[model samples]
Target: MTAVIAEEDINRIRWHCRRGMLELDMVLARFLEEHADRLTAPQWQEFERLVSLEDHALWQRITATSVTDSTVERLLRGCIIC
Candidate 1:
């Protein structure tokens, strides 16, 4: 991502990905752990933005209750198949 991800930042991102929702946590944490280093700068930034969302809002996007912004959806599309 930003000049290629550092191990330290990857760990930090992993911690931040521990979300209030278990489903979100699993999806995000695993995704970051597996691919944070491989992400583009935009993807990394978008992921940070995605994780910043509160639990209910995040869940709505994950569960399709709300057809929300595309940033989160695009990032998630790789990990989640609809």
Candidate 2:
């Protein structure tokens, strides 16, 4: 079964996707628009963890300069920047 995320949670995630960098914002926004509804439970958890990261760290992951959890890695790979 698909993981069900509450609308409020999705909204919260969207808000957090707003980063200090424009590129990060665009990349994350694209990812959410394309895949938020399709994430599994563990993926959702990893996504939350990802958004909690500082902008630079998150950006590093987006640019493939740093690696993180596999689930987060896979999710980010779906992003256009990856």
Clashing pairs in 2: none
lDDT of 2 by residue, 11-78 (tens): 98999988898888888888888888888898888888988999998877767845656866666766
TM-score of each: 0.70, 0.84
* Distance from true location, Cα of 23 in model 2, Å: 0.6
- Name the weakest run of 10 consecutive residues (lDDT summed) in model 2: 65-74
Best by TM-score: 2
Q: Which parts of model 1 are misplaced by more than 4 Å?
A: 1-3, 65-72
Residue runs of model 2 more than 4 Å from their true location after superposition: 65-69
Per residue, candidate 1 scores C-alpha lDDT tens digits across 1-82 of 2448777887887888787677787778656656665677777777777678898877666667446566546556456534
lDDT of 2: 0.81
